[model samples]
Structure formats: C-alpha cells, structure tokens
Target chain A: MTDARRPLQIVDPDDPRIAAYRGIRERDLVRHQKRFIAEGTSVLRVLAGQRRFGIESALILENRFAGVADILGMLPAKTRVYVASSDVIDAIAGFPMHRGVLAVGLRRDDADAAPDTARRWRTVVALSEIANHDNMGAIFRNAAALGADAVLMDAQSCDPLYRKALRVSVGAVLTVPWHRFGHADAMLDWLETNGFALAGLSPRGDAALEHWEPPAKAALVLGTEGPGLPDRVMDRTQTLRIAMANGFDSLNVATSAALVLHHVRNARTGPASG
Target chain B: MTDARRPLQIVDPDDPRIAAYRGIRERDLVRHQKRFIAEGTSVLRVLAGQRRFGIESALILENRFAGVADILGMLPAKTRVYVASSDVIDAIAGFPMHRGVLAVGLRRDDADAAPDTARRWRTVVALSEIANHDNMGAIFRNAAALGADAVLMDAQSCDPLYRKALRVSVGAVLTVPWHRFGHADAMLDWLETNGFALAGLSPRGDAALEHWEPPAKAALVLGTEGPGLPDRVMDRTQTLRIAMANGFDSLNVATSAALVLHHVRNARTGPASG
Candidate 1:
C-alpha cells in the first residue's frame, strides 16, 4: 500500500490551512462555517470511526501522534495530519490542550435526507430550550451510554457540536446521530408521525417515570432546567417524572435525562433488574 | 421581638467583618479556616434553616435583601447582615454576583457528635478519591434530591463546600450532611460498623446494578472518573456496575452516583417502578 497519509510537521502555528483550529474558544462563539472542532483523543477516535462527518484536517502534538496512528490511518489520503510541538499546538488552540489531539470535521447539511427510522432508530431523545452547553453535552454522553438511538433538538437549544460540549461528551456528540428542527411542537409532531411516542420529562408530569414503560419507538423529551417543558409542549405529550424525595424535587437536567433514558432502555429490553 | 438583627449598609467592599467572603474563588483554593461560603438564595435558605452550622454573617445586594427577608429573619440576633450595591458585592466576590446572595457558614468541628442515624438516615453515600469540585457538588445534590441521608468522602476528595461546588449544587452541598474520613477503607469500615452494606460502584463490578438490590442500610461508594475504585477497596466490598450500552462505558461520575443512588433508594423504599 502507498504511504499516502504521512504526517506533516507544522513548525508555524499560523499555517493558513489550519486556520479552522485557531482561538477555539472565541471561534466557537459564532457558527463554525459548517465545520466543528473535535478535541482530545477519545473525540478524535469517534470522529474517525464515522464516515458521515468528513475529517478535513487533524492537528496533533508530536508526542501524541504515535498513540493515534491507527485512527489517523482511517482518514482519507487527502486528510492533512499536522504534527506540532506542545507549545505550538497550545498556541494554535489558544489553550493548554494537555490531551494534545484536535480535529476539524465537516457536517453534512442535507436536511432533506430523511433518517432511516426503521433500521437506525428505536429510542430517541428530543431536547427543548436546553441552553447550557455542559448540560447539552452531558445529555449526549448519557444518551450514548444508555443506548438511545438518536437525539433531536429544537433550534432554541445550544449546539451540541460546541467545543466544551464535545469535550464534556467525551466525543459521544461526534458519534451519536442527532438532528435539529425548527420548533418543539414540530419535533414532537415529527416523532408522532414517525410512529414514536413522545414522553416529556417534567416535574409536573402526570405519570411517574418508574411506572412508565417505553413503547417500541419512544422519544424522551427534556427541557431547560428552571422553566422546564413549556405548557404547550407538555399538553401535546405524555408527561413523566422521576419521583424525588418530597422536600427536594430538583436534579440537574443531565442527571434527570440519564435516569429517564436508562429506565426507558431497560424497560424496552427487559426488567430494570437485569 | 426587637429589631436587633438589622441589616448593616456597607459602602466599603473591603469591610473586615466580611473578610471571609472576600476574593471568594481564591479563598476557596486554600481551606476557609473551618468556614464555607454558601451562595444564592436557596443555599442561604438552607443555611438559615439549620442551627447545626453556625451562621457567622451574610452579605447581600441592597436590591436583593428585601426579597430574602424571611431567610434573613431566621438568622440569630447577633448575626451581621451586610448590604451593599451590586458592584460592591461583585467586587468583594472577585466575580459577578448576579444572584446577589451569599452567606458565610461555620462547619461543626466535633467528629464525636454522632449523626442521628436512628431516626433520620437509612441510606448513605461514601466517595473515594473524588477530586473534582463539580462532581463533589453534583453528588451532594444527587444525594439530597434522591433521599440518600449523608455523604462521606475520603480525605483525598475535594471539599464539597468550595464556592463553585456549593453554587453548582444549588446549595445542596450546604444542606446535605457530609463528613471527610482519613481513608477509603476506614470510611467503609465505619459504614460496616454502622450497619450498612457497602456497595462499591465499578466498571468491573461483580454484579449488574440493575439486578443488585440494596440492603436495609446501604452505603453506595463512588470513586473518581478514571482509575475507578482501587482494587484494594473493591476487594473488600460487594461491587456493582451500571450496565452501560456496549462500546460506551463512560458516564460522568456525578451521573453514575445519581443512578446508583436512585436505584438503591427505590430498591429499599419500593420497586424500581414506584
């Protein structure tokens, strides 16, 4: 086989080709021009595992490149693998990236291509107005760990592809299949049309989470922390709540999502007492 | 009753009486000299509700003081309540004080004052090597929200009373009864002596968390994110796993604690479907 994917030494941090990876925190504030930064070895591995997200280029600290050769080999011959010293890599990213691995992945913008629900999805998550990046990332991590098929978020929700969220997710955000829709009601309606039961997680839910079993196809809905699911959304879906201790009804939304997702996954597969 | 607990208006942010609250973040790095800062209205409420933790003083934004009259009224007559402009409060904190509510609480020093377990506690959580402040805070929040009676962390763990932790926990850190012990084994031994079945959470656990039912008095032990519970500790107790989805065995430590704590709580009180 031809050694086409040799690593390029990046002595200068300001190389124009690697501009997509500069000042990551500030750059993440605006839309990334259809590209997302995947940080750390774990996230890079996930990004390399999938073909849907095209790997445009990778910047790695020289010391860490050897550890990730197998993953790098998975990329196309055109993919630029730029190797730099620790200081150069840190300078490029504008932060101390001790993990020493970063990659830029391109997103597929084809909204018209419908998801193959029958084969690819069964249990899905729908998030409404989840503004916190950490919470959004944690939800993706929980969804991946607990066997949720995909995630659907309304436009109001924070972008799961944001740097901190991607890092917090341990790269699950890169691997998990997720889509964004315009409105909460439209997302719920889409799930309904696709033969999925929409279960909205709320403090004022009518059914206790422990008693609620997932249908063959279920969409677990979560909302922002304090305001929770809007009455309009709650009115359209079956509401469920994790029965908390009487005096303390609050749990971080991510923790709430994990418990709910785990319950749904277990309920569908078998009893909770596996 | 006399208006002896009147709020004192302080224009100077450098007032020595509120020195415990100065440079809050930096002060949190070193120990608070046996004191902790509780932030936000909710934590202040919990601080005021308890007599066990001595309320040394409170600092509030002038605009927010009227909103917390009930909580302020609960403080002892000698407790000083300092009121200042939002800018002064922010400057004093070395950060923006949007919530505009803060209180300094003194932790009880006597380890011999045994916990009133006979009437209040049936379930407890013990943590080993949990160094993350956010994780510690989340665990405290989870413990309080899910009915776990107390938190026992090994000395290696970060302080739960750190400002960020206290804030992240939404003041749950202040409300949850917790203690730090010398070693992991010693804490576990103490739990055993107190009639608790120590269940250590590990990825290599001998039993699946779904099938493992908690005993009447269970102590759920959690470790740090990576290099989970040490084998020495795991060898001494019944170990259990959350049974994550294949290929993804990761969940934030706080989320893991929440799930295990929820399972143990429900198992003891009722079925998982309660």
Candidate 2:
C-alpha cells in the first residue's frame, strides 16, 4: 500500500493524535456522548463495513496489524490508523486489552433518522428500561441473528454502542438497525398506529408462547431483568410468556429474548402458520 | 426459631470456622476440589432445598439474617451459620460480598448418585468443551428454566460448581442435574444406550432447527463458540442449525441453547406435534 494509505506509526502512548483511544476503560464511561470503541478483530471488521457509524481512528498492536491488513486496507485514506507496541497500547488503554485491536467510531444520532413505522417489517424488537450493557448487547446479537428487522430501545435503556455491549454483542450492535426513543408510551403508540401487533414477554401473560402466533407484522417487546416491563407498557401490549417447566422462572433477559425472538420468527414461517 | 437454628455470631474475618469463605475469588480456582460457594439469598434458598448437595457452612452479614430466616430455618442443625459485620465479611471475601449471604456446599459425588438412564426424561442437554464459566452457568439456568431434565459435559469442560458459574447461573447449577464424563465418545454411547436421539447444534448442520422435531427422548448437544462441536461428535449425531438472517450467524452459546430448548419444548406440545 502507498505511504498515504499506510497506517500511521504511533510509538508514544501519550501521542496527542491518538488521544481518542487513551484510557479506554475509564473513557468508556463518557464514550456514548459521541463515539464507541470496537474491540477484537471481528468487531473491527463490522465497524469498517458499516455505514451507520463513521470510523474516526484505529489503534492496533504492531504484531496484529499484518493479520488485519485486509480489514484495514478497506478503511478510507482519511481514517487514521495508529500502530503501537503492546506495552504502549496497554499503557494508553489503562488495562490489558488482550484483543489488541481497537477502533473509535462516531455514532450516528438517531434523532434525525427515519423511524421504521413507514416500512413493512416482518419482525421488530423493542426494549424498555434495559439498563444492563451485556443484556442490551445480547439482545442486539439475538435480534440480528434471528431475523428481527429493527430494534427500538426506550430512552432510559443503556446505549448499545457502549464498549462492553459492543464486545458482548460480538459486534452485532453495529450490524443491527436500532434506535432510542423518548418513552415506552410513544413507541407503543407508534407500533399500533403502524398496524403492528405488539407482544410483550413476561411471566404474567395472556397466552403461552407455544400457543401465541406472531401477526404478519409483529413487534416483540422485552424489559429489564428483575422489574420486567413497566405496568403501562404491559397494559398496552398483548402479554405472552415462555412456559417454564420447573417452578423456577429465572432466565437471563437475553436468553428470554432469544427464545421469544426465535419463536416469533419461526412462527411466522412454520408449517402450522395461518 | 430455636437456639440451635439461630445464626451464630463471628466477629473476626480470620475465624477458622468460616475459612471456606475467605479469599473466595482466588479460592474459587480450587473450590471444586472439595466445596462450592453459593452466593445471594436466592441461590442460598436453592442450596438449602436441594438434597444432592450438603451445606458445609454459611457466612452471612449480621444485618441480613432476618431476611433469610425462613431459608436458614430449613438448613440442618449440623450446618454452621457464621454471622459477621459487612466489613468483616468483605475482608474475608477479599472483595465486597454485596449480596451479604453465602454458603459453601459439598458436591455429592455422582459415582454414588443414581444415573437417570432408567427415568423417562423428555429432554437432556449435553455440552462439550464449554470452558467459559458464565456460559456453563447460563446453560444450567436455561436448562432448569426451559424444562431440560439434565446436563452432561465432557471432562474437559469447566466445573459447573465454579464460583462465577454458580453466581451467573443464579444458583441453577445447584438445581440442575449434571455429570462430567471421561470423553465425548463415552458420553454419546451412554446417551444412545439410554435411548436418547442426539442433536448437535452447529452452523454446518444437516437440517435447520425450525424444521427439525425432537425425538421422544432427545439430547441436545452444544459446543463452545468460534470452534463449534468436534467433527467426531457432529458426524455421529443429527446436526441442526438455527437459521440466521443477514448472513451474520453470531449467537452466544447460552442464547443458542435457549432457542433450541424452547423450540424442542414447544414442538413437543405445539399444534404441529404428532
């Protein structure tokens, strides 16, 4: 590759040009304000491939660069790529980043992005008060893998672009189309107005998931672990539950979402479908 | 409650009576050699109720004793309950034990325990090389919640009784019946002899999960992420795949188990069932 297109060598951990990649773990707290840190080679590939997020810069350990040359080669010439020694990289990140691959990407604000209500969707996932980063990431991964067209999280929900969430989602957080909305009430209203059937997963539900069928256009709504969906949200949507065999009803929110999303996706195309 | 049932007071962190509770995060590495630490009130409840495992001792923060009185009352008189200040408990744990409740239980050797081969089990989950404790724990939680009867892991798999696994499993590790066998071949042979139809989850499967129906007695086998089920095992069993959308087939092993288990459970009872 030409010098202009080659990755910039970053020897000093304190280099001002690569300041955006410094103290990643501590800096992650405020990362949602503008940018996201994509870790690991797989996540970085997704980051480079996606159009929704703009790559600001990449910091990679010297040894790992050759292995990821194909991915790095795809980046725009204007995108800065900082190569550093493992020690320098560790010093800048404030913790041992074993993955040795990092990318800072600017998140596209959804405030001006068009809502999915106008488009015909087969399956959509909506979340309320999903504050946990891992759970949020898992939900995005499940949604992306299970054929959900879009994801909508309430304003109170944790950002999917959070570094831990991004890593846990296996970079599905970048691949999946998602938006953050103002209120559960407004999102529910929009779904109904768009001729979409809303089904909320809860222990207390009107129908068992095995018996419930997703409408042609359905939005599966899920909530946080302990409290579940708010009373107002549950009241508006048709509540559905995965029947637990044992007396224990404990399931991680992400697992529950996967079960429900898989069921809804297959229910639409299964042999017994109406 | 009687005096014998009341929790005993232990002021010092170094008290030998509660030695099992000391430096738990580090002690966890070798905890499987003799005892397993069960954390939180919910997990403690499961430990107290189970017959397979025997509680060695319990360490509790003095103030939280009243809340878990019912669970404590169920424990055998022989089981010692040591109560200390939150600070003392934290010091003993080498970290903040925010849950304020813990129990070290002796794992019942499966060699003495009766095998469930004769028992007519509708579903069983088998795992191979699941080194990740959180994934192992999550699988146990899913199996317990979703109606799988038991879990079988290869000897190479991480111990389910590991502390982090126990915590992530929400104590489902205590509730679910599991066994670690010498090799995959031996486990597969035993499963077949027990009349189970083995179905291994893999990206390169013969049939899609949505279309496949579980046999009357089914054993759903799953492997670790990235490097999936071994070719030896996959060659022997019926291979299955969860159809992914957008060509992005990334689902956490635990979430994949949830999807497969949910489908098999529902398929057995759904309208399309035989």
Candidate 3:
C-alpha cells in the first residue's frame, strides 16, 4: 500500500494524463464511459475501504489533498492521486467544483464472474426503472443503512455510479454489494431462483406491508413514483402497500424504499421500525 | 371560478405585473419576502386546493397552459393567470423552465390570528436546523403521508416553501399545516405546552424507537445531518436512535425522519413499520 506522501501536481488543465477528469459535467459523455466519478470527502472515505469497486485514480484540490491524503493512502499502490488548483479543477469539470475531492472508480461487474453477489444477500432491493438520480442515491443509502444485503437495479434505472447518485448514496453503493441486471426478467429470475420472495410496492397493493409476512429470504422491489410497476412485473411479485393517511399524501420513491427496506430488515433480524 | 379559460397573453418578459416572477432564480431576493414560489403542476395543484396558503397568481407557458388550466382554474377568481412564450418564460426565470407551471403563494402568518394551528396537531415533526431543501421537502412529504398533523421548523432551518423544496415535497408543504419558530426554546415550550412528548433522534439515543412507547400527542424532533442535535435540545427530549446494521452506514436526515415518523404514527394509530 502507498503511504501518505506528496501527490502528483498537475498545473495545467489540459494535462493529457487527466483526460477522464475533463469536462465531466457533460452528461452524455460521462454516461457512456465505463467508469464512475466519486465526489466529496465522505464518499472518498467509503471508497478507500471497499473492494467491490476498484479506484482508478483520484483528482483533488491542492489545498484539499492534505486533508484527504490519509484516505488516499489506503488505496492500492497502483492508485494515482493528482492534485490541481481550483481553477484547473473547475475548468476540468466544466463547472465550479463544490467539494474538492473526485475519483474515477472501475465497476468490477463481478455478478457473472462471481455468483457471491447474487448468492450472499438475504434482504435485497430491486429497483424497477428509477430515473431520478437523487431517488436512486437515496434508495442505496436506505438499503445499506437498513441491512439490505444486496441491491439490484433494472437496465432502465439511472446509473447509481452517477456523481450525484454516488454522493447522495454517501458512497453506500461502494460498500453494499450490488448488481445491475440487463433486463427486469433477468433480475426477477435471479431473485426467484435465489429463493428471494419478491414484494412489489404500489399505491394499490394486495396487502398492507406490515400485514404481509416475509419468508426467510425476501426482495423489496420498488417502482417509479407516477406509473408504478407494470402488470407483468406485479403479477410475479406480492404487491405490498404503505398505507397513507390520505390519497393526496404521496410519499417520494426514495422515502417508500426506506420504509419497506426497514420492514424487511426487521423481518430478517429484529424489530420492524427501530 | 374561471372554469379553465384561455390565460391572459404575455408578449414581453419585462412586464412589470410579473416583476416577482423576473430573475426568480436570484436566491437571496426570494427569501426575506412574505410570499413564496410554487413550481410544477403537482405543487400548483396543491396550492389551488389549499386555503391556508393563499395563491397570489400564476405564470404558465403558452404551450403548457391547456395541460394545467384545469389545475389553475381551481384557484380564486381574483388570481391573475399569465401565459408567456418559451422565450419569455426562460428569460423571466434566467434559465429554461423544465416544468411550465409556476405560482406565487402568500404565507398567511395566521398562527397568531388562529390558535387552530397550534391546537389541532396530534403528531408533529420539529426540525432543528435543516440546511438542505431536498431533505426539508422530503421531511414534510413523509410527515404528511405518515399522518403527522403539523410540522414545526426552527428559524435556522431552510424554508419548505423554497421552489426546490416545494417541488421535491410534491407540494406536501401546502397540504401539511406548519409553523416556523423564531428560536429553539420557543419550539420546545410550544411542544411542551401542547402536550407533545419530544423525541430527538440521535445515533446515541436513550432508547430504541420501537421499545419506547409514544404518548397520545408526540413530536419527532430532527436535527441537521453531520452535527446532529445540540446537547441542550437533546437534554429536554427523549433521545432516540434508528438502529442500523453498522456504524459505517448512516441514514439521511430525511430517511431517519420517515422511519421515526412511521414508528410514531404506528404507535398512535396501528402497527409500527406498516
């Protein structure tokens, strides 16, 4: 492991070595890339300890490097840390950087390589077409905090590794084991084969969540806010509703995930709403 | 009732009648004003239905008017409706408006005039100092959905009426009765006098939420993320913790509020975590 030391200094914004860091705010460009950007001190710290995702390199503000050198030191010896001035950093991102720390992380894509990703989880969260980055991030955060062992997202769902989602998840995406399925049926088949009971959340559900008892292994499948799960998907899973005070008070998609994930964790471990 | 008629045409962006709508993106000016902006069809719909927060007027895109005129028609007959071209709407906002519907709302400040505000709440969410608008909005949404009768915010907390907060809340702020206390002590005294048992959520809570039975009237006091509630506040309330899988996985402030509020509502109404 590399010990804390002076990081490489990049005085120029157009430095070819830091190509991946340039104009990162360009949404389309960042999306097609195989890697993901991690931002802020909290997320960077989580990335330092996790092995599920590999850290490619780090770009830090000159002043911020000192504050986070200890965290960077924990990465593999091959990990690169590039320190730059605020101007260079802002120019590279195509926007003024709010927090100083940024890093590119390589997705391991280990589900097919290693079945442990699918086999290990007792409590899972399967997301069906979540488009909002904030909601996507919140789902991962809730899953990690409530002890949902794995997170599975459909292909239509936005990338969890997106900078906003990564920061919002507070880097839980790094810690919690996750797999992105190419399609909804693939994810459903995997969950079914893995002995995970599928519980789809909807406005009109077959049973109230508390009233429905979970089996030994369970998966909480969350749908997008407005148009919930498709009939085909709901047909395969037990529809559970979070009964509200009135028809008007619709909970946010992320908020619903937190409530459901908490209930499943309770069923597997201890009390439901602790 | 206007009965969904064609809105008044706005050819120029600099129309003085729409001054409040001009350069609305300027954050500071939006604050310190008695009125607030409500954005998107969802928020506008809620504003139209509620009498507690009075609707001043509305600004809609020429193309988007027909889609939301029914919603706008629900407003009072005196409410002026302005329909502008995309250019004018974009120029007035200083950015391209994603959702065409925007409305100005008047804060009634009727807590003093009407004791019904203080007297009606059986369950309340008291925010200590929430800086994030998204979290603030989500808190209100969860409180409203989970049967929290009122929301109380300390002076330092961000305004729920802020555009992003209102939009993220799905306009729950308009539906849920709320008050902003000038100071922490005032909020504490109000809850105390109103017969609400204060429960401050902390990592090091005195009792697990599930085990601690809530009284008839209870208030869940939430602190800002990172630096949680101050000792002075926690000393007065029963400190509660959301038991997590590990110390590493931290819940978002709003996520914690949802869980705690769900638990409180369950205690008062039915089963916890439903």
DockQ by candidate, in order: 0.53, 0.53, 0.55
Clashing pairs in 2: none
**TM-score, chain A, per candidate?**
0.91, 0.93, 0.92
lDDT tens digits by residue: candidate 2, A1-274:
4342477888888899988888887776773568778899989998888787889889889999999988988787788888889889998998887889999988767532357544867688889989888898888888888888888888888888889998888888877777777988888888888888999999887787777767988888999878888888888899987788667876788888888787776777673221
| Alpha-carbon deviation at A162 in model 2, angstroms | 0.8
Give the C-alpha interface root-mean-square deviation per candidate. 3.1, 5.4, 4.0
Prediction 2 global C-alpha lDDT:
0.83
- Candidate 1 global TM-score: 0.90
Candidate 3: lDDT of B162? 86
Candidate with the greatest TM-score versus the true structure? 3
By lDDT, is 2 or 3 better?
Answer: 2
Q: Which stretches of candidate 1 lie over 4 Å from their true place?
A: A1-15, A61-70, A83-91, A95-99, A110-113, A116-120, A272-274, B1-13, B62-70, B85-87, B111-120, B271-274
Put down candidate 2 lDDT per residue, B1-274, tens digits, no spaces.
Answer: 5453677888888888888888888876772567888899888998899888889888888989889889988888788888889999999999988899998989767622245643767688999999999899899889888888888888878998888888888888887777777898888998998889999999888888887878999999999988999999999999988887766876889988998888887778773221
The per-residue C-alpha lDDT of model 3 at residue B10 equals 82
**Candidate 1 on A15-57: residue-level lDDT in tens?**
8878998998897887535888898888888888877678899
Ranking by TM-score: 3, 2, 1
Q: Model 1: per-residue lDDT, tens digit, B19-137?
A: 88889888888853588888889889988887667888889899998899988888888888989999889889998989899988887775212554434567888899998888988
Order the candidates by lDDT, highest first — what do you get? Answer: 1, 2, 3
lDDT string, candidate 3, A1-274, tens digits: 4532447888888899788888776752345356779999999999988787888899999988879978987888888889999998998888999798999888765622233545656778899999888888888888778777778888998888888888999998787777778899998998898788899999878888877678778888988889988898999999988878775636888889888877776666676353
Which candidate gets the maximum DockQ versus the true structure?
3
